[model samples]
Target: HVHGHFFALLSGYIDKFQLSEEWHRFTGDSSITDVRKCYGEPRAALHEVCKYACKFSDLDDPKLWEFHQGVNGGRMFDPAGNLRGVLTGELDQDSLEGLSGPYRDWVATWLWLEKKYHLQAGPPPTMLPYV
Candidate 1:
């Protein structure tokens, strides 16, 4: 079953923005919980979904550090889904090699920037790439 509370929250925003038509097209036959469409173009809906989760700058340093400690060393997201074992390094090299390209490039770039700047990949990393 869909999470009614979350859907209601998004539905409120959809109604407020008068995006019923676009929302219908975006959801199609999928459950309300499905957010795969938000990753694509027309990111207004994605912004709605992420706004709450992304608001950390408003927090003061102590509160922010407390929040960090609460979630540190925990897996915050499961991007691998069914391929969790492979992503967690439990699988052989061939399986992992298939997933390398873009991810490898991104990490290499991030590492180079971090080392060059003597910085860590904090919530707001010091380096940002131009699109």
Candidate 2:
């Protein structure tokens, strides 16, 4: 019974376990050589994955914003305090219930397609201060 709360919690795990610098310790590789290597394919870097995911605007709805907020909070914004992505919003408890399943499924589908097609580089989207 995955819900918005669960998805929010899972995002933290994804960032900490898959996207952090300590990922090398888990993968036993200093540099990520393969996108398939990490759990949820998160080793590719958030900006890269964000660009890849942004192609499908349908996936960028409020659920995505909530998920990122749960994981990284305001850290996604630029130093100038500009929020990333044109579509941004706050998620409420009511909306979370409806979006939970669809959000998870969409992410899974995106990762599978990304692996199958080997999507390449593009101009980084305007998200996160570091990006």
Candidate 3:
């Protein structure tokens, strides 16, 4: 069932992108690829994947700087594929606009409180003269 669903989705994607020949060349044997069912909360699994993708342990690591330079102007999220329209703002414009008002208000309030009282999420505001 999972393999069938995944193949259907892949077929749709290939057709949409006109990449049938390219996919065939890459796969070589179409029967080699398979999808297996996994049990877990989907949101948790997604969170774990995102954390692994964005993990940067040491700020002073040279590899981090190298990676940063390599992908400087490129989109770290989806450049193209299923998530292309989503990351590029082609979808959910209206829904995001509705969210912005409340989100902005919440941030504003949080900042005000942090400023008024020295609520220490980080170094106190006074310590950072530029801020």
Q: Write the residue-wise lDDT of candidate 1 on 50-102 in tens digits.
A: 34443553566688689889989998665443445644443323441112111
Off-target runs (Cα >4 Å) in candidate 3 are 1-33, 48-60, 74-89, 92-131
Where in model 2 is the C-alpha error above 4 Å?
1-22, 31-48, 53-103, 107-131
Against the reference, the lDDT scores of all candidates come to: 0.36, 0.36, 0.34
TM-score of each: 0.28, 0.16, 0.26
Q: On residues 1-131, what C-alpha lDDT tens digit does candidate 3 reach at each position?
A: 11122211011112323233434444443433333333466434333333443455333457768877988998755434443565445432444211111110001112222322121222222221211
Q: What does the lDDT read for residue 7 in candidate 1?
A: 16
Error of 3 at 102 (Å): 27
- The predicted structure with the larger TM-score, 2 or 3, is 3
- Candidate 1 lands at a TM-score of 0.28
lDDT of 1 at 2: 12
| Index of the highest-TM-score prediction | 1
